[model samples]
Target: MEASKRQETARAPALPWTVRFQIFGLVAAASVAQRLNGTVNRSFFSLVDRHVRASARPDKFGVRSDDVDVDASRGLWARVFKPSEAQSPLPVVVYFHGGGFALLSAASVPYDNMCRRFCRELGAVVLSVNYRLAPEHRYPAAYDDGVDVLGYLEKNRLQDPAVQVDLSACFVAGDSAGGNIAHHVAQRWTAAKSKSIRLAGTILVQPFFGGEERTESERRLEGVAPIVNMRRSDWSWRAFLPEGADRNHRAAHLTSENADLAEGFPPAMVVIGGFDPEKDWQRRYADLLQQKGKAVQVVEFPEAIHGFFLFPKLPDAGNLVKEIKAFMDKSKASASSA
Candidate 1:
């Protein structure tokens, strides 16, 4: 949490930068092709199983990555990364990781790197939540976990006086499925009139905000190596939703209402990858907010893909880290002046 430590971590040197992404892609493609006869959902899960096993970053802070289990029914687990120094009431960003809701965890290296960088660069308390996955707990479970974490932070305020977090500057963020959760949480906060916990902004990275239907990119990317396919997306939705429920359930998809996404909704910074299948949805969300007279920054990384933020070796990944830091700093400055 010291300034020096944070600086070092933020600019942490490459660990060989040696991930053989191409080989991994080839292996994944072969696996998918082999399982083509099975349900698309199950085929996708085969790749997920490999990813979960391969991505193993050791726990930092002497805290087990899965230390806090908040609820059983909702399967809420959180990993907290506290800044070394709390000079003032610093910001707190609770992040939800991507993977279509059913295929990732708070412990994944890709997300772990992001959580660390956010904590280091912004000097903010960052908590990565591992909400319940699908096929067991679907639909409302993810949204419920997000809301519960906000309440947990408010309830535990008194216990960490030294770790000063500006309640007004607290934010929730996520990528893809996680992004959907972030949006739902912000809406829930507005509905409850939760004045005790204020959010400065919400950040969505390649957020998925649509139903099973295919966009142009999704159609174009069908069976394309290293790009998301509409078929896979359809499978993910089925896994995320409860039996017999539509993926476009009003509460599940944030694009359904202008009222829930009005100007009072938190100012947002949305980062999209030009080639991501969900690019259209990201654009729509940005335009929707701007039309509503809200402050929104849409940053499109031209050469990146859906999970570019996780690919540290890629130049765009570091660029995004820089971009997010700038947004948080400016917000902090404005909050200070106000």
Candidate 2:
């Protein structure tokens, strides 16, 4: 890790003057928004996302993507990415994007581009789920939408017979708030014992989880880490959790001593950022899974901060892609053997 860190520092390029200036202004605005209510901050953040968002371009990295409907009446839809010349029966990854569960969407520039990279590099199809957001549709809405997407997949097709996908090889994955949704969705899906779709595993990248008690990491990294800080994190929890609910709610707090797992919860790969304020809680979640005798893998990026996976130029981001591919392959083999 030390060598990788040194190499990354040597190779990482500096941001252009214009981009740096834009970042400076954005950060300044955020500093002010932090004092306002979560709703206003959410609106401001959404505007920023709309301005920088990349559209659904299919040809990037030889991966073709299109909008797929799940339940248009409820405004539930997703973006599907399929790599060129993909072999039949390839693994399918259902991905959820991170925005503290209140901001950002599947169409957000970074997430769209990241899914394209996953399709090309991993040689698999990626379904970027656009689950309903919080405050507007709080609590079980996102989680329910997640399970609904699986249900939709079971009944529908990729619409391309040339490139068949293995539903049995299906995997649920997400980053940040999406990661939290991924875990709950997997639990519900597995509990139902859906014979049509087998959840091979889950990939949680810097998953968002919290509790009433602040961990050492949270207190120490409060204002140091970028994007995710103590104040904004708390606001997100309030918005996403049920009304009048506190951080200790079951949805936000999954590390309770008596927390229970679904009977067939799949294997998990937990990514940790050393500099992230939530690392302590992330570690606790992984520990709970391990204590239950679940097959879990913890991948840590020592110098990485929160939301590190969203940046492509970062060495850690590329390394994470490789790690995800390895986990998919290993989990697939294990599932087949079982």
Candidate 3:
């Protein structure tokens, strides 16, 4: 009954200069195309994406990754990361990256770095999916890819001595649109009654959810947040949603009073950032899951921005990784007890 009862704002330190420079460049790519049409300038932004490279060798954190094809014909693949010094079968996190469903990939530098952190810190295996983007491969495309990866996990093994994964404690995790996709993926996976992987829980880092009517946070922080503004948010919805569909479509408008979750929907971890305009929607989603009788954990980063988990310069990013580890441990404990 009370959404405003959360933590007060606690501003993290100013972003490092290197991060500021990248943010300014990304803003250029996104801001320039607003005048032309209701679309993103992917060509310009692709330059920034080029630097999101992946390597198969172990990095400083002792995590190594390699890209594995899930379905080459459809350009569906996943970057798999695991600890180099694997001592046991670790939980597998099926990670989907954020780009408003129309941009970025698992190969992106920030995502790659984050996945490595997940592997090294949590002692887990990460399967970061490179699902197809929207305005080209719209609604259900990414969802389909998300589900298919589970099928791949069921039939395939890491086939490497260094990587040992435990599908019994699998998790669907993502940020922004990918978080939305993670929710639906879990929904679809649970609905089908597949025993391929046991979904212990889901981790939604500032999930991107919206409707035709804006929430209070959206109005209050419309331009205050650095990356997202009203224009960009609307454009992302237009590009990702089905042609001619409004924001009220089931995918975007997820917090209806009657939003139907499957009977066995797993527990969830919802991350919120005060500076994110979408913060209210994320809270509504947690409320919805609770109303539906699913267990929920809410983590607050009062002064953080959208996609803050992607950059390590922000203290909240490290804090998020620790929260994820604790959530996973709790989920596994609950599953074992159940």
Which candidate should be chosen as best, given lDDT against the real structure?
3
List the candidates' TM-scores in order: 0.80, 0.89, 0.93
Report how far off residue 270 is in candidate 3 (Å).
Answer: 0.2
Local accuracy of candidate 2 as per-residue lDDT tens digits, 202-246: 999999999999987787666555667788888888888988999
Q: Residue 119 CA error for candidate 2 (Å)?
A: 0.6
> How would you encode candidate 3's per-residue C-alpha lDDT over 52-167 as one tens digit per residue?
55677678777888889999999999999977767678899999999888888898888888888888888888999999987788898999999999889878966667567788
What are the Cα lDDT values of the candidates? Answer: 0.69, 0.83, 0.84
Instruction: Report RMSD (Å) for each prediction in the order shown.
Output: 8.9, 4.4, 3.0
TM-score, cand. 3 vs. native: 0.93
Clashing pairs in 1: 1-84
Rank order by TM-score, top first? 3, 2, 1
Top TM-score prediction, candidate number? 3
Residues 12-88 of candidate 1: C-alpha lDDT, one tens digit per residue: 12222243453356336534643333233545544543432212233453212223667766557787776544668
- In the predicted model 2, the residue pairs found to clash are none
